[model samples]
Target: MLKFQEESLRQSVNGALALRHQINPFLDAIFEKGITNICFLGIGGTYASAMQTVSHMKEFTSMEVFAENAAEYITTGNRRIMDGTLLIYSSVTGSTPEIVKAVEKAHAAHATILAFLDNPNPHLRELCELCISYPQNEQLKLFMAADRILFLRHEFDCYDDCYENFDCYLADALISVEQSSDSFAQEFAKKHCNDTLHYFVGAGNQWGSTYSYGMCYWEEMHWMATKTVSSGEFFHGTLEIISRDTPVTLFISEDASRPLSLRVAAFLPKICANYTIIDAADYPLIGIKPQYRGFISHLVTHAVTNRIDVHLEAINCHPMEIRRYYRCLEY
Candidate 1:
């Protein structure tokens, strides 16, 4: 709890839970229209988290799903995002220019848009057929929205029973992550404050955390050099750059790909001594059932990383809010 606010986080979690109700009507509307494919679009860290959520949807559901960068989709264009496509947009600020443009493009293509905006933007909300506003924790809101859609479509089998216990599950998840903030994150930050150019790798659904932490936190927020490699692809080319002094981190989840992450965790310390592993198994997920750990592992991982970000901010003598280019200067 070095730089974290417990009450604020609880409120954010509650706001995310409220999205379940806000998103149900949209799901009903889209299902009635016979949603053919789904597209998740956002900019920056939102895009990174979307990749993980899309991976989760793809793993269990038969629906055609995609996660796209808002800016790149504008240039390349996805043919599948037309007519019956259920397009989801996420913008924590509701003011990212790229997201606003992507919303317009998707709307013009006649896709039914369900946007999760953290802040109110009338212009952007007008572009969407349905919009749900939440205060913070945009990634969790978007993931739950996607899960709700999958649940309504009978695509996510664990939805009905697991969802009934969601309130407890969510509260426990946040608490477990809170408990680790002081122990793991603070210690890690203290030991590795001077290291630059970090390398992070994760597998399966957890790979999204790898990308988000490296891209959004390390590189964007902390202004440090970092590379995110998928666990499956790490041995292919990324391992060649390893050195004893390299600051390599591995994110492990309890899902099916836990073994995949374990593979890297075992290999990294053999050649590189400066490696660290942050696995969800280490945390006490109080209210979450053992069988459903995989589904919420991303959330837990993200929460822990949030702690690390704050600790890094304190140690580096730089606040996480400081940015030189993002929203500070035109691209």
Candidate 2:
């Protein structure tokens, strides 16, 4: 049972990475037009992926990036959907109704549709200008999406060595995988499972990190009540939730988001005995050898995020089929 679960996890990672491989060239072609603006239409894993893309594209390219939430896109006004925009649509199964509608809107406007699809969903392909297959998960498919960012932002040849070791690294993501280090998280989860509220703390881009791990995974694995507010956000209003009755998990990024993640980490230990703090520096599961540590960290974090996603689907009837639903809803 565990082995099957592990394969399921690795397959999700491998499947998403494969989609990135196909999407890169198409993205290159669209960017070649030197379009001034970029728009991403998505939610959940797709939204998370779009955020990473938005962050990276800003640092490396001059394009103005905007991400429209899927809900808004489903009901947006025609003029509100601008022209000359590069619409990057992400639907893991290629069948989100809102995304499909967004794609149609972009089509009517003559916008370029660069999609990340995991399967051969014909309707999505028919709607898009370039429909490339890439798996972005429903809740926490950030790891695979992070790699798609790296592929677009950095030198591919430099990181080509990275994919070679992915199978081995992913194997470790399962309990038998090398860096499971399951004790701390398992014990911490046990003590706080019944606790109704929890806070996820992280600094830098680590906000995304903890958001994926603490909120996404907890929601999947144990159906734990999780709120994914950043450290800064945590200190804002919800910090009142920090108490003996409410446990917290602090997810910090090493070089960035640190000052805030650490600051929040320091504050929570004082109020909550059930508090558990995990510094990203001490965790190697987030480390993907043969690549830059930052890239590896994002990829490893993504794998764990995806794993929790698989575990959740297994326990529930929530099959990952965003594409299938869209076909029914659209036509």
Model 1 over residues 1-331: C-alpha lDDT tens digits? 6767777777778667766777887687778869889898977788887888887788777889999899998888888889999888778788888888888889899998888777879998898888887766766777787788788777777886776666656765676676665678888888777777889999878888789889888888888889999999999999999999999989998877888888898899779988988888878787778887787777788788878888889889988888898888878
- Minimum summed lDDT over a 10-residue window in model 1 is located at 163-172
Candidate 2, residues 90-206, lDDT tens digits: the string is 676666666777777778877767666778589878867776554444322333343444456553444356655654464454334213533443444345545566666654445
Off by over 4 Å in 1: none
Q: Output the worst ten-in-a-row residue range by lDDT, candidate 2.
A: 138-147
Candidate 1 clashes between residue pairs 3 or more apart in a chain or in different chains: none
Question: Listing every candidate in turn, what is its Cα RMSD in Å to the true structure after a full C-alpha superposition?
Answer: 1.4, 5.3
